[model samples]
Target: MTKYCRYHRNHGHTTEECKALEEKIEELVRAGHFRRFVRKDDNSFRSHHPPRSDHRCPPCDSRHGKRLNQPANHDPQPARTNVTPVDPPLRGIINTISGGFAGGGSTSSVRKRHLRHIQSINHITHSHHRRRMPPITFTDDDFQGLDHQQDDPMVITVEIENYAVKKVLIDQGSSVDILYWATYQKLQLSDTAMVPYNEPIYGFSGEKVSTCGYIDLHIIFRDGAQTKTIPIRFLIVDAPTSYNVLLGCPSLNTLGAVVSTPHLAMKFSSPSGDILTIYGNQRLARECYMASLHPQLPILQTNHIERPPSSEIT
Candidate 1:
């Protein structure tokens, strides 16, 4: 009688000499599944082997394979175990084992790393939120004797880049400092000196204007015995304006300045704890206001002819 091959279910050869069964065993060993096929009677067979140095877990090497130690007949379905399944395309299964998908590390060190990251973000937010200047209180004496009936905007001359620039308006309603293109060119600054500015500015009339660029320059302000020099960033725009420059709220806030329109003066505390005051030039303010309105005013021409023209027409 011919010996039967148990693996291939053929009568041509015995199971030990079956080429198909040998190939199947080799495939199972390579896949790390050879232990599942071991017979119970084979007590001398060793199912698990120590992992080679290169095959050990990169994160923590407690086992040979990424799979947890399981019984030989354990179910293959994922729902049977609490272990999360790892994506096969990924390099290793340690990501699932360490719980890295929950926005943090799998081990104690990883958790510490995540905690540090969160703390850094919180610190930055707190720093920005807590930034505030000291109390800035104004008194009646801050605007002594300069109060007069006037409807002109506050205008002054300030030293910029060592040059006295006239027609500089102090506007508390403005959010950013502005330098008109004419004034910028008068400073003799080249195009290469300007940095790119992405923000746009809108006027009171709701007209939007794109900025040309921006430049940083030192501006010097004087108030009798006290003088303050600050670096001011001016957004350059090529629009027709009566004023050469505008000092807005940003500069005022940085200097802790307070403006009194009725007195045509501005006051701030100096670094040396002295009160610094700068009075506006009332005449320049009125002139700039008139110039701003000149383009909008209509022009009318009157012509008178002699009486002889009327008699000749009749």
Candidate 2:
């Protein structure tokens, strides 16, 4: 038979009772003092402290005061506020008239670029106005050979005044209108003509390309069989590798053009008697365009929701 101690193995009490120790322990707990207690089984002895009085330490979670179902009291902290200073409203008024433009940040190179654009524009405009040449006939009356396979495109057309140009392409996708300087010289827009463009013309890599400038007199397109003519600030650029002249937004706005690439067409009309219409194969245009339509619906302006804006309708 197995022999057991004075107290049973299951109970935490030791086999040998220490009566005076038990008497003092209960008194300390009642007085809110921390106390340690130990218990063991027949196999081995292990020590552990029993929990103290009912009152919990602060920050401690318990069922008595706060309910178990109550959510934690912490709320997220607010985000830090921006503290950057903003420009004074009067700065525009002051800068607009004053000769000092970009202020301390203006670099000599940048200033020269601005001056060059101004001077070149003046030179091109002056030479174009003073030294005239027999005008080139710009006809956009439905080219017979232009028809072919095409993807869907949104088409728009309008007239830009006396621009002496057949078509105006407003590919918001293109960084800028690329023009051929040779075309301007061919127009008899002669020398003292230094190509003064210094600003980087952006391209596919989103990098600037070096080039010269020229004047395209106008834009011509079709609005449902009616011819349209629009006036524009045309740039004559040297683009030997590409098309003769490019019509960037500056030219397109002058012509009031609406673009449609996916369907491979565009629509425009001029005040002039000749109607201009074009149809193209998107495969052909891939060399020139990166279509810009987005997957999300554009937030329609309140006025433009039902119909196109007044400027567009005209």
* Candidate 1 residue-wise lDDT, 51-102, digit = tens: 2243432232367654332324532231222333445686643211111113
1-314 per-residue lDDT for model 2 (tens digits): 22222322322222234232443444444443442332323222221334333343224245566533223554223233333444556633211111122221136677687767657866666755664322223334433224434442322223333223222234554434444565455334554444354544545544445555434354445444455555544445554322234555555544444455543544444455343445543332332233223314332211111112223332
Residue 108 CA displacement from its true place in model 1, Å: 38
lDDT of each: 0.64, 0.39
Model 1 residue 44 distance off true place after TM-score fit, in angstroms:
99
C-alpha displacement of 103 in model 2, angstroms?
19
How much does candidate 1 score in TM-score? 0.50
Cand. 1 Cα-lDDT: 0.64
Q: Runs in model 1 with CA error above 4 Å?
A: 1-147, 296-314
Off by over 4 Å in 2: 1-170, 192-195, 214-216, 222-225, 269-277, 281-314
